[model samples]
Target: MGFINDLAAKFTFRPGRGRKEQNGLLAEELAALAKKIERLAREQYKANILAEQSISMIHEQRAGLREEIRAGAIRELAMGLAGDLLPIIDGILACLDFAGENESLRAGLRSVLDRAEVALARYGITPIEALGGKFNPSLHNAVEVVEVSDLPPEIVLKEITRGYRLGEAVIRYSEVAVSKSQTGTVWPGME
Candidate 1:
């Protein structure tokens, strides 16, 4: 009986040692679980930041696209308006030339010109100064060359037709008479 009891006692687990070992294992497992949770939390934070950045980029792209669309619409509108006004301006200039020395007719023509200028100014349109200025091929179409002793060669002496610009864009180029030196070097396009 004593031998059997001794063997049973040897094989049986003691509460104190078992509880201590179980507690140690539980603590290790809890620590590992805490580390895993912290890692997951950090990953979640990084993912959130990435999502926010993506959203911001999308918003900026959308805004840029909207601005481009608006600018295109404005450009189209300005072109159409300028095209409509060109013929009217030419007619007014013709009338002014034909008014001659009649004071009343000249006054009326000047008033019309003023109104036209106001309308053009509303859309950023303005005339390019050609007469008495240096001839620029980009702004002026040289229709004729006049012999001039006072002015330098290539200087614009007269404007046959006025030129206009809308925000740095030439809507029309001036038909101009350029000065030629007495030497008659034969300006370009003249045989």
Candidate 2:
């Protein structure tokens, strides 16, 4: 009887003590789980911030690439148009050279040249100043060298074929005759 009563007491559920102990264990487990969840959330937030930064960088690069492509296409189109107009101008100039002494023909050719210049100006195409200017490799191609005692060496004495440019871009280089001094050095102003 005594052993049975002791066993019953040991196995018996005391609501106050048993429930409090179980609740404390449950609370500790819940706190641990909550801390783990919070840590994961913080890590995920940092990852998201890094991802957004990467995406922004990619977008900037893409925009810059698009701008470069657009500029290149514009340059190409301008060059193509200039290519078509240059030969016509050259032919007209040649005719003008041959039409000398015929006042009427010279006047007609002069009017045509004026009109062509105006049309080119409207499209941002302008003749590169070559004659009397210092010869630049970028804008001038020296086909002939003339030894001159009066003028500075490397000076452009004459433009054989005119150069044209659209905005800062040179479409064609001027074929020019440059002066060479007796000493064989470039002009003073030229580097």
TM-scores of the models, in the order given = 0.66, 0.64
lDDT (tens digit, per residue) of candidate 2 on 1-191: 67447645654676566777866765776687689779999999999999999999999999999999997887777677778888999999788879969999999998998898788877778999998998999999999999888888888998889898889888788999998886655665766
The best candidate in terms of TM-score: 1
State the weakest 10-residue window (summed lDDT) of model 2: 3-12
Error of 1 at 190 (Å): 20
Candidate 2, residue 132: CA error in Å? 3.9
Q: Would you list the C-alpha lDDT of every candidate in the order shown?
A: 0.84, 0.85
Cα lDDT for residue 175, candidate 1: 95
Residue 74 Cα positional deviation in candidate 1, in Å, after optimal superposition: 1.9
| lDDT (C-alpha) at residue 75 in model 2 | 75
